[model samples]
Target: MSTLEIKDLHVSIDTDQGNVPILRGVTLTINTGETHAIMGPNGSGKSTLAATIAGHPRYRVDGGSILLDGEDVLSMSVDERARAGLFLAMQYPVEVPGVTMTNFLRTAKTALDGEAPSLRHWTRDVKKAMGDLRIDADFAQRNVNEGFSGGEKKRVEILQLELFHPRFAILDETDSGLDVDALKIVSEGVNREHAKGGMGTLLITHYTRILRYIKPDFVHVFIAGRIAEQGGPELADRLEEEGYDRFTAVEA
Candidate 1:
């Protein structure tokens, strides 16, 4: 099985005040067939960790290493990282004005696989995935994420996850703006991908609602950019009842 390892990861961003730290020596490891949930309050650096892993330009890794199966992920460019099988489903997905979803998916798959997928199989798979996610068939012909609602964008993100079949996926608060039905649909999409036993999921969120559908094998509490506590599914239950108040108090 493939493994994604993060060791003593310290990340920061340049600002008017100079570099400000966001992730303070955060470290975690995820293996294929496992699901990890990162739970925390606002400004706790959950999304920062996700962005750092996906090689986002805004966040700089000042120290530490992100290794994918012993390969140095920190050294790889964003596209290189993606080609190496890391996928990030952003919390706020941006719109691509000119790219059609159909073209984008096929092009990305070709890049990732180093060859074009068979057109017939690709079309069938995309249609099935979209249907499973309850996405309108017309969406394939539309520009990427253009005019889609929050839930629609999130579903599209998962659609990519299903089609791309990355070794690991970092979902940054995927359930944030989804209603109950949309949440279940999106969660089911993730579950379907995870069930394949080839993809590891790093699900970052603040609530336990999504946990009901996408159960994490490990639950980590992110407080001030560091994992303060980690446990099995039981930890999520505790967070649901107690919330991050206790963790914040401890951090304070």
Candidate 2:
């Protein structure tokens, strides 16, 4: 099985006040078929970790390592990382005004697989995945995320997750702005891939609500850019009851 290992990761960003640290020596591991939930308060560096792993230029790696199946992930470019089987479902899925969803998905799949999928099979696969995500057929013709509702954009992100089938996925606050029914539909798409026993997941979230739908194998409490505590699913239950105050010496 594939493995993603984060070893003492340190990330920072430039600000008017000068460089500010975000992720402070974070270390964790995720394996194929496993789901690890990173729960934290806002500004606790949860998104920073995801961005760094995804090779976003804004987040600078001060020090540490991110290994994907023992390969040096930190050395790879953003596109290189994706081609190597890493996926990030952004907290804010951006809009591509002119690119149709179908074209975008096919192009991305072709890039990742190093060969174009046969048109017939590709069409059927995309249609089935869209149906599974409850995405309307009309979206296939619409520009990517152009004028999509929050829930719709999120569903489309998961649609990519299913179609791309990466070896590892980092979902950064994917539950944001989702209603109950939409959340369930999105979670089912994720669960469907997870049940396949080939992809690992790092789910970054703020609430336990989504956790109810996508059960995590391990739970980490991130506070002040570091994991202050870690445990099994029960930790999420405790967080729901007690909140992150216990983990953060300061107010959360």
Question: Which candidate has the top score in TM-score?
Answer: 1
lDDT of 2 by residue, 1-252 (tens): 988999999999999999999999999999999999999889899999999999999998999999988899999998999999999999999999999998999999999999999999999999999999999999999999999999999999999999999999999999999999999999999999999999999999989999999999999989999999999999999999999776676645
| C-alpha local distance difference test of each model | 0.96, 0.94
* Window of ten residues with lowest summed lDDT in model 2: 243-252
Q: Model 2, residue 131: what's the lDDT?
A: 93
| lDDT by residue for model 1 (127-170), tens | 99999999999999999999999999999999999999999999
Per-model TM values vs. the true structure: 0.99, 0.98
> Whose lDDT is greatest here?
1
Give candidate 1 regions above 4 Å deviation: none
TM-score of 2: 0.98
